[model samples]
Target: MNFEDFIISPRSFKTESWQIGSRISKGIKEGSIVLLFVSDYRGVGGDAEMQDFTGVRKEFYKLSQLDFEVPVIDLGDLVSGKTVEDSHYILQEVLSACHYKNAVPVIIGGSNDFAFSLFSALNFHQKNINYTQISNIISLKQGESINEQTFLSKILGSKNFSIKNYHHLGYQKHLNETDSIKLIKEVQFDIVRLAEMMNSTEKTEPFFRKADLVTVNCDAVESFNDPFSMNPQVNGLNKREICAYMKEIGLSDNLQSVGIFNYNIYSDNQLNHQLLAQMLWYLIEGINIQRSHPKERHYEMFYVLIDDTEYAFRRDVFSNLWFFGKDENIENCIPCSRKDFDEAKKGWLNPRLMKI
Candidate 1:
């Protein structure tokens, strides 16, 4: 439950990814906050040799430079030779215990697959708990009935889960498996495709609205963002675009937790570590913006219809609640405030459409 428990030194593991920082340690604690869960879980296997979580831990050190007090709990090792499901259950118990005292859990992970454990820990039992997933690839390989990346498939295929309220960003065209895309569409995940992000003028602001947790995957940001990554995809979003997206998402009114995963320190050069640091700073910037937004308010905007009909409405931008007159064409329209307009109209909002 202490900061010392969260960090692992490079010398502890004879692997490529764990070499950047001599010792991986948690950020400095200044807040009364209790537990923050972070770990280097690659020791178990599969892409273990390929993962380098050291850069992210380096980011944690930089975070320490800032003025804050929150202990980061490091869970030393991922249970070896166990299925992803087993890890999920194990982390679920740990996280539930950590959150019991209102502690914010920030997880540092080896792969996008790590999210399965974090999500399982979160439980998503309450309607108020909104989840947001950020990844360059959809990570939904449903047809691979017995594949390593079957976490998403299992979650969506299960009858017990109610995942209708989640949002997914950075879905690349070729990175997604066909069946995965089909499954994603069927599940109604709000996808902001790489093409759409590149082509559109807006950053993915709308998707982050009211989210309770933000899960980030380093692979989602092209290989350039993390040179240490072995399987970096060329078509991924650039560092700048990824930062902007994270900033917008972090600034959302309802976001309470944030996570960064899939960083491979082994493949990284000095440049990659620097980029990782910058990305972490941007993530914090997003949190700062959310804290600075104006207080909650119910406001109305009027628009004239082609038939000259006037619509009167009231909306809570901060919470995304809405009410309108019966005569208004509100069927396809949900209630939103000027906050929505501001977000939708932001200049650097969407980056999936970029030429890169």
Candidate 2:
């Protein structure tokens, strides 16, 4: 597929030698991070006409390169199709191309429902996907048409999509429907409240460690001077906290795709643009840092006996990351925290960790 046929080149921006934009190319390279902008917001009751991303690009382009080893490519805005379904098809094609090149696609500027397209495209190449989403609302309203409120239902209900695990983070209890939250719990999926996500990323880093697809709903972020998301909330993640989480998302060892959706495309606030740009920078920074780690890892094993049962834990000597399992085989291990290991020594175990 010719990416140029489906994408409009990003507007030219002047850049200094040390800036990130100076290193970003227009063409996709092997093992690159590809940025694709989608303007289709019809799912969220907005028009398909091109949304100006000049503010974001300007901020992103001016940021320091900061020793990044991975290539970055801006594929520009995706052409909106006649119908929303058509737009999904176009997006899938572009994503497939990125996958073929062993590149990670960071989708920007689309309605939250476009997450469905990201799932569909990745499902074609792999199964038993681990999806992690950061959204303030968890709506499972049944509908034939896909929109922000109903897209989660479409993803969870589709038989064609093989989701091994789904983690919904940053959901605010007051904003979510009781039934929807109940349903998610009933299905044994992980649903984390907004309060659990604030202040630190250590506890939630495990959720993203094995994620294959991670999507962020800008609505989960709090608005300051102007609205940051299409449906901004008064109580949500602050700029610093959200940027920290974005780095965790990028640090995922198994990450394949990402989407930043429900962003307030119409906002003229430079702060909002600057925040988004910084989020992207932090994500890329995490990716570069992870890539620098040793390919072959060694672990230190520790064991604790609880109720006549031996529980085992392993800590990577290189990364200092902990995992819980019966043995040393990494596949059999579940990503865990030092806190979990500490609790186990006291003859206690988190039931949720056992379930996973």
Candidate 3:
């Protein structure tokens, strides 16, 4: 696929020699982090336009590149098709191309519903996908059109997609329907409240550790000055907390794709743009750090007996991350936290971990 045909080239931005943008390549490279922007917000009742991400690019390009060696590419803004479905098709092709080159595509802009495209594209390459989403609202409305309210239904209810695990994080109890929340739990899928995600990323880090795809709805972020998201809330993940989670998303061992959607493209606030740009930087930094870790890892194993059964937990010697399993193979184990291990030693187990 000649990717140029499907998207506009990013506008050139001035950057110092030490800045990250100065090191960004315009073409995709193997094992690189690719940025793709979309402006089709029709799903949320906004018209498509040739949106200028100059503000974001300018801020991102100016940040320090540090010692990171991972290749980064700017594929530019994706061209909105005549129809929303057309946009999805084009995005799927572009995402597939990136996957073919072993690159991770971080999609920016567009309505949150475009996440369906990310899922479809990855589903074609692998099965049993582990998807994690950070959003303030949970809607399961049934509809033919793919909008923010009905897209989750389409993904979870669809017979064609093979989702091994799904985690919905940062959802507010007041914003979500009781039935929808109950339904998600009845299926044994993980759904975390906004309170559980505040201050620290330790408990939630495990959710991102093995995810194959992750998406963030900007509505889940708290707005300041001008609105930060299309559907901004007064209470949501603050700037620091959101950046911490972005890094966790990047540190995923099995990460394949990511989407940051429902952003306020019309915001003129420099701080909002800077926040978004820094979020991307933190994500890239986490990816670089994860890639730098040794392929062969060492773990300290501990066993806890509960109700006549023994459970195993392992702690990584290098990263100090924890995992739970019944054996020594890390691949067969589940990502966990120190809190989980402590609770286990007290003869208590997290039901969610048992379900997985």
Candidate 4:
């Protein structure tokens, strides 16, 4: 069967952008992993004609030629009908298929709303799924419209899913509405402010550890940095900085999947596409690194032979190697018990590097 037959473009513009045939051929030759590439038409409307996919198709074909194998699947046509609920159902079907096949889903949509169906799918498959989502907007008030402010809000407003496992990263003061802030706090999200995210790397570490699935909305990049995104902002991180965080987080051995959304062609210049491609490259590179270096090392226990004291104490090394203890005090070297020790071993740690 033809692999391109499975490819669905939501709009003429998206089809025009793809290089499907060559991409499919190269993907097959490379024995690449299956990756769903959902492309959407801009605006809220009915099904549109499948236009010529020359520009974007060439890019996908070129990307398929990389040494790594990646079979490109499409779900752009699933969002049919006038209701947002229809788009939601289409997203669910696409993601459910990905989940069944153990494939990664890469969605490029008209707005951040593309994530709602995926979110709903996770909700449906709640027993077997875990989500780690990141968005700039904090919440969607009851009557908010689908313009620039309410994109993330709509997802937030959707009722079926629980926000207990959600992680809201890079929230800006100016962009979020007052009601959104209240709702975010009410939902108990681990909010990592844009300033705090940039202030220190260690401080932002918790957000990365919270999930198996990670979603990045392109608008998270600073307005100046990613002019092409739907709603760019002055306070957000730049493309390089955001991509670095993605790389570092993707290095985590626990990540199951990832998605990038809201990359409107009309929003920016040609530079946006290049930036998006680079960000994706970072993600793929990060996953490759994690796959190669699967094992995470830690000092299980230190058999310190204290000759002067005439005792060979088996002190359990609870923390990672980098732990220098809380401050410069030797008292912090208290022996760790089994329960506490297991939690400390979550990430890689080097000797002489411990902090609060």
For this target, which candidate reaches the highest lDDT against the unseen true structure?
A: 3
Q: Residue-wise lDDT of candidate 3 within 1-356, one digit each (tens)?
A: 55579788888888889999889988889999999999999888887887889998999999999998999999899989899988888999999988889899999999999999999999999999999999999899999988889899999999999999999999999888899999998998899999999999999999999999999999999999999999989999999999999999999999999999999998889999999999999999999998998999999999999999888889999999999986667877889999999999999998877863
- Give the TM-scores of the predictions, in the order they appear: 0.67, 0.97, 0.98, 0.64
Instruction: Count the clashes in each prediction.
Output: 23, 0, 0, 20
Per-residue lDDT over 1-356 for candidate 4, one digit per residue giving the tens place of the 0 to 100 score: 23234455433323222333343422222222334444353322322223332333334434423443345433333333344544445556666666566555555544566665556655565433335555677656444344334445655556755644556777787777787777766766456677866744455554564355677776677665436555655666776787787775566445655667655445334456656666665666566555565253334333222223221112324323222233233323422233233334543332112222
Q: Evaluate model 4: give its TM-score.
A: 0.64
Q: What is the C-alpha lDDT of each candidate?
A: 0.52, 0.91, 0.93, 0.50
Q: lDDT by residue for model 1 over 62-116, one digit each (tens)?
A: 4432422223333444332244444455555655655555444555545556666
lDDT of 1: 0.52
Model 2's TM-score against the true structure: 0.97
Off by over 4 Å in 3: 1-3
Worst lDDT window (10 residues) for model 4?
A: 304-313
Q: Where's the lowest-lDDT run of ten residues in candidate 3?
A: 1-10
lDDT ranking, best first: 3, 2, 1, 4
Off by over 4 Å in 4: 1-6, 9-82, 126-130, 143-164, 199-202, 224-226, 295-356
Candidates, ranked, TM-score: 3, 2, 1, 4
